[model samples]
Structures are given as C-alpha cells and as structure tokens.
Target: MSDEGRLIAGRYRLIERIGRGGMGTVWRAEDEALGREIALKRLHAQQHLSEDELATVHERTRREARSAARIAHPNVVVVHDVLDDEGLPCIVMEYVHGTTLGALLKGGGALPPGEAARVGLGMVAALRAAHAAGVLHRDVKPGNVLLGGNGRVVLTDFGIAMATGTSTLTKTGEIIGSIDYIAPERMRGHKPGPTADLWALGATLFQSVEGRPPFRRATAMETAYAIAVDPLAPMKQAGPLEPLIEMLLAKDPDERPSAEETERALRVVASEAPGATMGTATGGTTEVAWASAVPSRATATVAATGPTTSAGATLTDSGSGSVPPTPISGGGSGSAGDGTGRPRRKRRRLLWSAAAVTLAAAAVAGGLYAVTADDGGHGRKGSGTATAPTASEPSPVPAGFRLVREKTLGVTFPVPDGWKRDGRASAEQVTYTDPSGLVGLTIGTVNPAGANPESHFQNIEANTKLNYSTYRKLRMQRTTFQGKPAAVWEFTFQGQVRAFRAIDFGFGEEGGTEYDIYLSAPEAQWDTHRPVFDTVKAGFRVG
Candidate 1:
C-alpha cells in the first residue's frame, strides 16, 4: 500500500507528501533502521503507460537514481538509498526543509536581479558537479531547484539524467526536458552536451528575472516555434546580468560560453548587487570571454555602482557615485552580449529543430511536466457580494492574551503569550507559530483579483482539494465581522506528521485589499486551540 501509514521496504515509513512531479510523489519519510528522517520518491503509476512501458519506466528510475547517487556535492541533493517497494522503485534522499524556486516565484512574482544571480550560481555549480561526474541533467528548470532552509540551493529530481556516452532511451525524434528551456541542438536530434545544459540555465535565469520564460506561448506548437525562430524577448529587469544571459543562450553550441565562464559572469553579477553576497563556487575556473567591447545601458548602470573583477580587465566608473570603481583582474567595461558577432543562421537551425523535437516529445510522452504546490498557504482571493455586519465593538480579550499590532497590514489582534511571529514581517505577510510547528497563525493580503471573501474561499478550496490528502471542508460561508464583509473557512487535512484542523477568516477592506487570518493545529488538539481563533477574531480590527 502506497497510502499514508504504509511502510516501504518494511523500513521506510511513509509520512505526508512534500511534493509531486511527473516522475513521482515525494514524501517525508522516517527511516526506522537509522532513526532519521529522509525523503522518499516513489514511482507514479502513470495513466498512459502499458505493461511494457511501465517496465521501461521502472528500469529508467533505478538507473537514474543510481547515477544521481554517484554525484556528491553540497549543491546537489544527496541520494541515500534505492529500494524496490512492492514493485515500485523508491529513492531515499536527504530531507530538505524549504521551498522550490517555482514556489518562491509564484508567491512573489519575479525575483530581484541579484537574488536571481545568486540562485543561478548554485544551479550552475550543480550542473558543473554533475557534468564532472559524466552525467547530463536533461531537465533543468525552476521546479527542479530547491532553496533550503539554511540558505542553500539544491538541484534534485534527476529522473531523466543521461550519463556520458550512453545510448538514447527516448525514441527517435522524441525529446525530454521542459520545452521552454530546451536547447536548439537537442531539438534537432543532436546529442546534448554540457553546453546544452548551459543554454537551459540561461533560460531559467531569464524567467527568474523576467517573471516568464523567454519563449512562452499559448500552445506547445507556438511556444516551440518561438523558441526556434523568434528573437529573445527584451529583458527590462535583468540589470547587470544581460550580457551573461545572452552569451549562455547563444543558439550554436560552440558559440555559447563554457560552464566555467558562465559561473564567473554569474558570480560577478551576484557580487555586484547591492547587499548581495556571492555563494561558494566549486570546481576549476575558466578564462573570461568578452561578448562585446562597448557597455550596454544596463551593464553601464551596474558598473557605475560597484566594483567587478576579471582577468586582465579594467572598469571605468562613470561617476554614478554608487561605489568607487575597483578593478580586480580581467575586469573591463560592461558590454552587450548579443551585440557581439555570431552567425544568425544558427538561430534558425535551433528554431526548426526545437519545433520538430517538441512536437515529437509532446506526441510520445504527452509532454514533460512538474506540479508544485504552494506550501505556505499564500493563496489568491475570489470575488463576492458585500453585506454590512450587525456588530461594531469587539469582545474582551481572553485572559493572558496580548494585542499585537501589524502596521503594514494595518490591523492588530491578540496573540497567545507563547505564540511568536516567525521572523520580522516582509512582503506584508506575517506568521506566528506556537512552540511546535503543528500549530500556527498566518496573516497576509491576497491578490484582490475581483475576489470577495466567500468566493475566494471556494477558489482556494478547489486547488487544495486536488493536492491535499483527505481534505475535508467543514464550513465555508459569507458573514460579517467588525462591520466588514468577511468569510470563514474551516477544514481538516492530513499533514506530514499529523492531521490538521484549520480555520481561516478573510475580511475585505476598501480598495480591494483583502486580509486573511488563518490558524491551524493538530486535529487531535483542535478543541484546545479553538479558543485562540475566537480571541483573534474578536480583537481583529482594520485601521
């Protein structure tokens, strides 16, 4: 049984699921033998597979897990063990507590250029390590990258990774990987090399800063066509990293910068961002390559603000007064990447090959996909009707509760003495946790996408029902609180360690600003924690 509470291989106890993707469901499991927590990835029973196809997938899973296990690096997720559990292959890996890059993007749109550069550097290192180990990560996208709690970037889910000199498992004309990030060479049936991974990295970086893929379209065909034939969309937010992005994204394999050169450029970008620090870059360094001699407008802006280092390079600060120009080695004036000379025909080849390969991959595998759930309960709001409430004044605060005011969200409430906010508030979201993680309170603003409190609950429920295990809704109704339109939604769902009972109160304020107050606790202790919800609601006020 793959259900919760079932033991895999009579050793790893299945905990609640942490994530799911095209390859399998990822669970936080307990290793009974070692008394340690770990992550378990179990193969999914794909609906499109036959008996033979299932066998092929199983073999591929085993091989890929073993291959990934051979790679050892801090930026790479460590694979602990591989086991056959009830005919399904399961991989045991280190349990990481954090969110994926995709989740971070969805929660707060595009990231700042410096932050994106930091993230890109980590992925580049992971790719470097895997490449050194003679492995090619066929799939490199935001969903596969993890941001750890300790501020580490980890690359995982090598389900389609191919080793060096290996025969192709994909049928003729069939390609894998996220379509938007696939290299032009791979689309043309050419064997993918390390340079291909570099191209995907460039695409990932582009999406990170621009809030969307460089070649996104309404349909697969159109998107593939765009990737192959169209010029890259102009980047307004890339800042100092535009030159690096252009160089990595060169259509021809030989034209693209090496991994070493790419890492150096990304590090320079990360290092130059205000208040941004560079992460550790492993492996040997490569000589810096110049994409252009004249600085682009964005590059000049970055150079005007900070010092940069490269081999035999010089920086002339144009008196922007941000920072004194300090040249380290090989550093020179910034330049436009695409402005450098390169044959335009390579882009055309890339375009046609990408279209052909994308069509074949879509037809055969139904397309490569990854499903990521937002972990922090930061959901969007829905639309509804407004009704005035009958009450105005709030009830007395429960004894021992203290009022805490959030000036940013312009509201305040009584928090239990022991409950404390997790870190200072930023982005208008504040979370308070009890001594245990099992119970917590979250208050934040949802996108006022024409959503009223009641309809918003329903829209969120639809998504939760699809992802949460055994999710049961008890009540979701429109009501009034503190003379404002409000909705209350209460439900129960299974978490990684226990069943949770949650209650949310969403209040609509003027200018379509919606505030949500949510509290969740272990279901077994719902009664004990229920009073806190009332305490918060009675004292809740909008300023």
Candidate 2:
C-alpha cells in the first residue's frame, strides 16, 4: 500500500518523507492515539532480501527499538513503538523538529568550538547512559545526532547497538557502521566496546569543527585502510579540543580515556570556549576555523546556501556530510557574546605529554568547575552557578600551608605552600600536586544517592583492576570517618613511567553524598607523602 496519507497499525498517519537511506525511508507521521507527531521508519528494499536475511533484518529492527528504549537519558531519542506495515517492520521514534548535526555542518560549515562542545556533552551523556545499561551504540555519526528545536541535543538511530554479552547479529567478518568513523580495533575484527563509540564521537566532533571527517578518502576500502593503519592528521582547527580528539582516536581502545574522563574534558571545553558563530542575519562571527582554508568564495557560497551531501560507498553506512537541514535562529549573548567570538579569558593549553599532564591541562583550560549542591542528605538542590567564597569568612590556612576554597564544589582545604593545584576541578573532583608531578592529592565525590558505600568501592575497584596496569590492592574496608560511615582503599599500580602507591578514604554525608580524598606517590616513597594525606583530611570541610 502507498505509505503517504495511509494509517499504519490503525493509528499512525504518514504525512511526508523526511529522510532516505539505502535500507529505509523515514517519514513524518502523526500518532492518532497520542495526538503527537512521530518519525516512522520502514525498510526500502524488503523484497530483495532472502528469507534468512529478511529474518535477520527484522530481528535487527526489533533490537534497535529495544536498545534505544533501554536508555532513559535526556540526550537519547525516545522509541515510541514498533509494528508491521504491509509485512515490513516499522520503527516509531520521537520526531525531533530541528536540523541534524550533519545538516548544520552542511549549511553552516564548521561550528564554533563552544557550540561543538555543548553538543559533545550531550552525546557523551547519552553514551554514558547507554554503556551503563550494557548497550553499545555501534553506529555514532553526525547524521545520527539531532539538534532539536527544544534545544536538546539527542543521539538517535541505534539500529546496530551491540548489547553486552549478546550473540553477534552480523555475519562473521562483516564490519558495520560508517567506515570513516570506525575505530582501528573494530576494523581489525575486535569486538566493539564503549571506547569504540567514543572513537566515533571523536570523528563526529572533528567533522563538526573541521567540516570533514578525519579519515575521508575516495573509496571505502582506502578509508578503511587508512583508519586501520595510518596516523590521524593533526587538527589545525580544533585548538584546545585537539588533545581530546587525539586521545579519543587512539589506535588502541586501552589508551582512550574512560567516558568519565572524556565527559570532564568536554565539560571543560563547554564551560570555557568563548561563544558560537551564529547565522549571517544575526551579524555574528563568521571566522570559522576552516574558513580561510577554502580557496574559492564561490565554493564557500555554495556550501553556505544549502545542505551539500556525500553518499557512503558501503551500503550499510549512511555517509558523512549528507543531511537536509532546518533553519536555526537565536543568536548568542553575554558570556556567549556575539562579537568575534574569541576567548575572553586565558586558558591552560593542553600539554599533551603524559596522563598526568593531560589531567592538568584540562584543569588549566577549564574556566568554571561544574558545581553540585549537597544538602548533607537533606536534598540539596542542584545549581550550575559558581559560588566564590566570602572574603570575610575565608577558609583558614595552617602555618606552612595555604587555604583554598573552591566555590564550585563548596569545599575548602589547605595545601603545602610549595604544592601547586594541577588537576582540574569539576563538581565531581579536584586535585593538587607537587611541582614534580609524582606526588598528588585529589578530593572527589561520588553521588551514591542511596547505594551502599561498600558496593560503590567494589564496583570502582573492579574497573580499576581491569584498567590499571599491574594493580595491587592492599586494603579496601568499610570504616568510620568523623562519626560517619566510610571506606578506605589502598593500592599500588604502574603508571606510564613509574610505579605508584595510593590511599583513598570515602565518607558518606548526611544526604547520601559521598566525599573521597585520595593521595598518590612513588611506591618506595609513600611514607614521606602519607602525612600530607592526613593533613588534607584534617583540614577538609564541605559546606
């Protein structure tokens, strides 16, 4: 039956086609029962598939709906329902009424770093939620991210998600997802993981700011080969994002930072980047990162006029740069100013040396720490506003130390006079270190909300043991801190250049907030640094 103006499952009324791909067509439809619009997707060539292939495709569509439905984060699209229409499977999804990120790039060219960072944070949140639910979104690209009219950046199209420990659905040795964005490990036939999704996120961010994916080529085979064997070209337009992009695109999944770490870096970028390059009608900044590189004004003019598309050579992948966009309005203001959009404050450039340096660099580059309100178990409302400590009732400093009060974390502590603050501070964590970088002190919080304290440590220890090199646990026991339930953990591990010992204490606050203090040093010299940990714990106070 013709889909246009037809009702499916006795409720959905197809209005018009919104998108097309090799395997399916997406239509804007209205849900008669719910009285709301939706996106209805159905296969394009169902008649061509053999019986077995058809079954597999059907299973895949059902899985896509399940996979997307499993995640409940704000940044993920909602799956409404799935049903059969004329013997073909159709997926009902929330209709996002804005342009795809791919389309935005096509129409506006490279986006400003601040805008890209904002978009990236939403994607990371979606991925984090999916990974936590044991789902791996196998396909993550610019086209799958929706920039919604409600100002929500959502990740869509999880048609190829690999649910954890589930049996493989793809034929043996057949790769899936966009070739240009595929991780090196995936190309080598390794099972996909959370890091693989991160690699695709890196490619998406790169394309958002550079107007092209990093591994583009004339053919799919060449692009795959380049992804598998070649080094990433240096990013000239990425600026501070360069280090994060480089780390995410690491050839080895083991080398990529965890989702927690990546989110922190992106938050730093979002909080610090100046503003966005808005539409021409608003008279905002036109100085995109790659604007000077394009030689012809006519080509630039063509790029600016409408969506410019490129088709993927592989049938399974929806190619990069292909999108149909909707217009965007509402220019930037205030801190997100409308002028040249250059950074107004000086930021710490990414040192890009060792893991320690990477952490330190993020701190330097970040302007505001992500703040959270902890009401000592009384339900403190969350706020993003920074709260600098009052000049009158300053945190007290010890004789040989300086008092540091962080308005974001709403905490205060003392550090040795010679010690410098090196690590970044988010609402979640903060750090300080000696000039040598070997000895450090970190204060952090984990929102247990209501989970048991011991289980939290157990889970963290499990992940640490898996990821940390030559990790050894000395002690991890439930204890008491300042008359409160707490846990203590001690361990030793190999760093990139040396062996290190560390001690940690996590105490539960009245409102189910958990605060932790960690200290690390050279394994052989741990005793010399142990006293500093005691001193920090003694002086630490959270309001």
Candidate 3:
C-alpha cells in the first residue's frame, strides 16, 4: 500500500499500511465523517476471483460486522463499518495500539510462566463473552489476542470465525484456520463449531508458554504428521508453565478446557508471574516489532510454515512488551502452502519406471485419524524438543520431474516441488510421487494404444474419485494446469483419504505427447491443501 492517500467507499482516507495477507491488505485510515482512525481491510486480486469465493468473503465480512457489532464487550475488538471497495469487500474496524504477545517472547523468547497464564485467561474471558453472544472465534491464536494500553486484552479479526448456533458459511470440505491451529475434525474436512475455537486457543496458549506452537515439523509434510499424530504437551522447555498450558492445549476438543474453566484456571495461575501487582506485570523492554513497539496494538516476524504461514508469521501479541521473531525484510515473501492431504501407499516402482503396477497390486491403508478431545483438561507436556530447522541444511528438492512433459504442442510448465516425477519408457504413462514417496501419480498419454479421448476421459472420471473419513464425492472440472487447458477431478475417500490424481495431456499442433497429472493424499489433508489443486491448474501450461 502507498503512503499517498486513497479514499475507500468514498468516506475513509488511507493513512498507512497496517498488515497484509494472502486474503487481503489492511490499512490504518481515517473516517472523514467521524474524524476517527479506523483499520481498513482491502482485498487485492491479481487474477479474477471466483464468484463463490467473492461471495463467501463478502458474506463473511457482513456476518463478522454484524457479529462483532453485537458483542460490545471490552474484551472484543470493535467493528465500526463494512465497506465494499470497488467490487471487493472490506471492513473498517477500531484500531487498537499495543504490542503482541509473540514479540514479547521472541526478543529473548521466554516469558514468566504466570504472565503467560494471565494472557491465556484474558483470551478466555474474551471467548466466553463472544461465545455467550453466539459467536465462536474459530481462528484464535497468539496474534488475535491484542493488548490495550489500559492493561486489557481485546480479541480481533474474525475472518474465518463462525457464529455459534448457525450454519457455516463454507461447505464441509472447505478447511479454514491456520493449519497448525486447525482442529483435527476440521483437518478431516468437518465443519467445526465452538470446539474448534478451543482447539486453536490451546495451540495459541502453548506458544505463549512453550515459545513455539505445539505441532513441530521440518517441512509442511512433517508438521501435518505432528499435528495429526502428536499430543499437546508443554513440558521442560516451558515446564514452568505446566498444568495450565497442558489444560488449554489439549488435542481433543471435548477433552480441552472450557472457556470458563480456562478463565478460572488462569486467574489462579496469574496470582502466582513476576509482577509488582497482580494482573499487572506491565513493564518490559518496549522495543518490539512493527505496530507492536509504539503500542496501539502489535505485530512481529515469524516464517510461515507453508505458503500460508508467510501471512501467518509473527502474530500481533498486543501486549505492551518487547518484540521477537524475524521481520519480513529478513525473509522471503509469499504465501506458505498449496495443498493438504494424508499419505497414500503405492507398490515400489523405479523412480522413472515404465510399468503399470496393477492398481490392485498396492493400496493406501485406511485408519481413524486421531484428533484430541479434551480427555484431560490440563494440557500434558510432551518430551520431544520442538525447534526450527537448522539454517545450515537446505530443504531437499523432489527426486525427479520425469512426470513427462508434452513439448510436442509447444506447451510445458514446471511441476510443484517435493513431488517425484516419472513417465514410462512408453511415454504413455507418467508418475508423480508424494512427500513420503509412498503413493505416486499415474499419467496415461493421449491415444495410448487403442485408447481414445472419450475412453480416457472416462478413465480420468474413474480415477478422480475422492473419499474422506466420513464422506465421498466424485468432483471434476475443466481447467488448466501450468497454462495448458485440461480437465481436473477427484473422488473423495473418507477415513483419512489418500488418492492418486491424474490429468490427461491435450493434443498439440501435430501428433504430440498428450500429458496427464494425477495426485492424491490422506483425508485429514483435503481441507488444508485443497488450494494447491487450483494453483496447479491455474499454472497449467499448454498451447
């Protein structure tokens, strides 16, 4: 955003950039009519947005404005207005100034255990208030909880939030929330309610006490593994913040602490952080991250776990304190992720092999995905050490890109990284491997032997079925991958579904290699990484 002023909805004047994400950009602006500073949200669209997504954002904004307006609690951030800037939608919200909790921890990265509890309690108080008014803040995390100069905390940004006692805005398959904070049920592509909010809060509080979120991973694949398999434990590293941290960060939504319970527990814990006064360990190094240092709220620097994490890194802790995490300038820019899926198994085949390993010869195993229900209210401490990847080792690139490219029609594009590629010596078959190298993609070239396009499309139809833990669907569409026009489809296999997706190569100027790309994953991952399919399709290249 430029410093030069621009009017929004013909009423507000932009003052400065507050923050930005893959979804939209936020600005600190003044409402000329009211003569007050407001945080203005604007969406930037590089490509045309789908009508459904646009409506979802607009309706979500409208719903949030109404919901935020309804709950006029001191603990909740205020929404002043909703604006439609040109064809896109935005919100004008109260701009609070303070440091974020994340910044405070990262400067040196440790906080007095008691202070962390106080922060958690404040969040509970806010949640209780919102939930009571029929709102569930599904997207809770360290950043959403903001600190006020008045020594108070306010919850803000209800983007992916769902109002309680109401139908969800998106469908069952549309996964929302930060992946690390997303509930297991959500990971399984289920629509969540208040429990989802609790799961996210548990993750957020874990950060306050552990110095990092509970789920640890070397790459997107590993993190998904941990989030799906690891238990929420804040031992040794944040052993000081034991008991309470354990309670809030519980894996199972039902097993986790309730808002009321969390508030009561934290109140008990706050009586115990170093402070001149109870509920007020106020003084600290004020030099924090952007928006956080000076105080009208906060900001920080952290790397996105996936392409999405780039937008996710550094939460505005909102507490008045020192900042932590690296700044944006210190790292690369872009969203952190693409697609989400569980591992699928396949028969061993040479990296660039050319054989039709019979489909029934090998298969992906199915199992009940584990997501914690608050079995015990107190979050237990896990023993493993969770740390960032060492800077010395660079991530390894996928083993191959032999997935077969059709340059015959003068059309080709790069494949996504982390996937192993292979095309048969026959050129009619290509395979792309998953992160685990267990299951792989199978591609059938155009006019293979006696096979024709219609028959091939039928085969594509049969191959694209997607199955989840509880539901199944066969969805297909005509789109492009790497710029080349093609068809995309899927058959959802429930029970932590995993699959092999393929797209047939279209014909070129003369007789050319018709290409196809098929990919699959576990059910738990569908929602988290579904966007990648569209991304690959949008990037599809063909003449």
- Listed per model in order, the count of residue pairs whose N, CA or C atoms clash below 3 Å is 15, 5, 90
List, residue by residue over 401-456, the lDDT tens digit for candidate 1: 87887795576777888876655232334556666545666555543322446655
| lDDT of the structure predicted as candidate 2 | 0.60
What digit string (tens of lDDT, one per residue) describes model 3 on residues 77-120?
A: 88888868777778888988776665565643655667776677
- Give the range where candidate 2 is weakest over 10 consecutive residues by summed lDDT: 304-313
Off by over 4 Å in 2: 275-543
What are the per-residue Cα lDDT tens digits for candidate 2 across 256-358?
A: 5668767766666665566533222122121222122111101000000010000000011122221110000000111221123433121111122232332
lDDT of each: 0.60, 0.60, 0.46
TM-score of each: 0.53, 0.53, 0.52
Please state every model's RMSD to the true fold in angstroms.
Answer: 21.1, 19.2, 20.8
